[model samples]
Target: MIIQLLLIPALVLAVVSSLRSRTSLRGQARRKILAVLTVVAGVLAVMFPNTLQALADWTGVTRGTDLLLYALALVIIYLVGSTSVRFREQEARIVLLARQVALADAALRHVEAMQARSQQAADQAPVAAHRGVEGTAAAR
Candidate 1:
């Protein structure tokens, strides 16, 4: 009786879903396959819920929905933890790269300062040497 009651809403949803599926052949095909599979599984579950229950008991799961929710929660937790670790690792890498860039910039400034000092020494050396020569010539 409840299944009969469920049929109207299900058919309405299916029709509305089909109207939306005209945009993509793959989507339509997927929906058709899903509908067939859903009907087959629903009939099987209704007929043999006990058989599936036995399998679940062997597997130590009290209920199928409980097992499904547990599996989903485990996957979500693992993904979120891995994503957080990867994010922190990337942030550390970025900070290290920034420090390396600053070090390179400072080294460039140091090299420029050394080059200026070299130029000053080269210019003064020639002038000082010529002045020494003039002093000796003037003494003579």
Candidate 2:
């Protein structure tokens, strides 16, 4: 009775959160299906408590609750593994994007610097030519 009070709400919230999570369309569909199945199974368990016990007996488990605990453990393990892989993939993509942005910025800066240098040289050319002409006249 006490366990049901705790586990039912926790499981429902977990499913709700999973459904609300951002994922691909296919992933969202899969989670929605899983949530529906979870609710149906929960309803069946509440309506026929003896069914779980019979299933436990058939599966060679000592009790239905223990079987549930075992199943939960496997799920937790799988979620952790999948989350780790997803996190690593996201991290790699971020690093790649950062590198791309940095390279693009550096390239832009280099082009601007070259343009400024060329403009400075262009501005100085007339002054240099005037100085050369004056020197030639003074020498003559």
Candidate 3:
């Protein structure tokens, strides 16, 4: 029906997007395989709705819809957990990077301040020597 038309494409898109986002080569391969299997299973389920009922009965579930709901719930929980972990890791990396940048800035400022003091001392040296020579001449 109209729902089938809407759901099939949505399901395929979800699988593809999830598969495209991965952290490692091994994970990417695993997800790609899972995505293919999911699409195949989805196609089969759409073609034959009774198979889902049969599967539910075999699994001791009262209804196929209920089984699907349970599976969807599990998937949602897993995605939430993984997303939380990824965010935590990214936050930690950001904090470490900020600390390194702050330290570098402080070091640069300290070096500049030391250089300024040295330059000021050098600038005053000639004036101090000229005054000393003038005082000696006056005394003579």
Candidate 4:
């Protein structure tokens, strides 16, 4: 009873917080709902050991504890797999973002270089014109 009292409100708050978040609402709600349900199920299983035993008996398992352990192991494996997949997806997004940043930087540098070259050419044009006038005067 104490566990449910503590966990239920905490899980509800988590779901509420997720709902308020700016992320994709559907995904966040789905994940939070799954998490709350999993916790509730675990708490129910712990509270009613007899149910676990009955389930084990029906499934040909010798002990409720063994069945519980197997179920936990499978849950752990699934969570790990899902976490790994999310990590890889985030990694790929980071790589793509980095590429975009690099390309932007390169383009900025090219523009700066072109501007500098244009300024240099403009500065030399006046000097070249003055030198040509001086040469013609010397010829006269």
Candidate 5:
């Protein structure tokens, strides 16, 4: 009797989860489904004390305390995993930005070099013209 009752909720949850997974439920609907499942789990767990106690003993941990600890561990691991992924993505972006900056710097330097050469050629033209005029005047 107890075994059948215990399996009933689990079977229903498994079926519902599998069905929902196939059909894409997002936003509010997904949240509502999750909330309902959580409530069902709480109700079923309270209704069946022996199953919870058996699980606690088999795992060699306290009933409620160990469950809480495990839940906390899962939450922490999920948070850290998400944070690490974001950090990696940001790091990649930073590297790309640095490469762009380096390329821009190289281009700017090349432009400045070309400008300097152009200025030097312009500066010599007037002096060369003056020398040519003086030579022509001397010949006269």
Candidate 6:
């Protein structure tokens, strides 16, 4: 009886934590519905432990606990696979963004270098003109 009571709060905490951590509205809603269903199922399990055994027997499983364990394992595997896929996708996006930033920085540096060269040439123009005048006057 104590174990059954403990399961309720444990399930509630797990669901609450999962729900709070979700970033998307759709995800949260889906989680909320699943959580509600899970809690209801838990309650039903506590109220009628024999039902699990009945289900196990109907499904050709030897034991209810084994059935529960199998289901839990499948859920964990799915979550791990999905999380890995999301991580890879996020990593790819980060790499692409980094490359774009680097390209933009390189273009900016090239433009600045070109501007600096033009300014240096402009600064020498008057000196060149002065030298030409001096040479022409000396010739006259």
Query: Per-residue lDDT for 4-46 in model 6, tens only?
Result: 4544565555444443434578866876686687678778877
Task: Give the runs in model 4 whose Cα sits over 4 Å from its true position.
Answer: 1-29
Of candidate 4, the 10-residue stretch with the lowest lDDT total is 14-23
Look at candidate 1 and tell me the lDDT of residue 19: 42
lDDT of each candidate versus the true structure:
0.65, 0.72, 0.73, 0.74, 0.64, 0.70
Q: Could you tell me which 10 consecutive residues in candidate 5 have the lowest summed lDDT?
A: 15-24
Error of 4 at 72 (Å): 0.8
- Roughly what TM-score does model 3 have, to 2 decimal places? 0.70
How well does candidate 2 match the true structure in TM-score terms?
0.68
Clashes of each: 0, 0, 0, 0, 0, 0
Prediction 3 global C-alpha lDDT:
0.73
Local accuracy of candidate 4 as per-residue lDDT tens digits, 48-88? 99999987787677888987776665556546655665677
TM-score of each: 0.48, 0.68, 0.70, 0.71, 0.54, 0.62
The candidate that achieves the highest lDDT relative to the unseen native structure: 4
Which window of ten consecutive residues has the lowest lDDT sum in model 6? 13-22
Q: What would you estimate as the lDDT of candidate 4?
A: 0.74
Misplaced by over 4 Å in model 6 are 1-50
Give per-residue lDDT, candidate 6, residue 19: 34
RMSD of each: 15.3, 8.4, 8.8, 9.1, 9.2, 9.3
Give the poorly placed runs of model 1, Cα more than 4 Å off: 1-66, 135-140
Better of 1 and 4 by TM-score: 4
Candidate 1 per-residue lDDT, tens place, 1-140, comes to 33334445655555455344233678658756765775776577668878656645655678755544543454455445545655776788899999999999999999999999999999999999999999999999
Model 2 residue runs over 4 Å out of place are 1-43, 46-48
Clashing pairs in 5: none
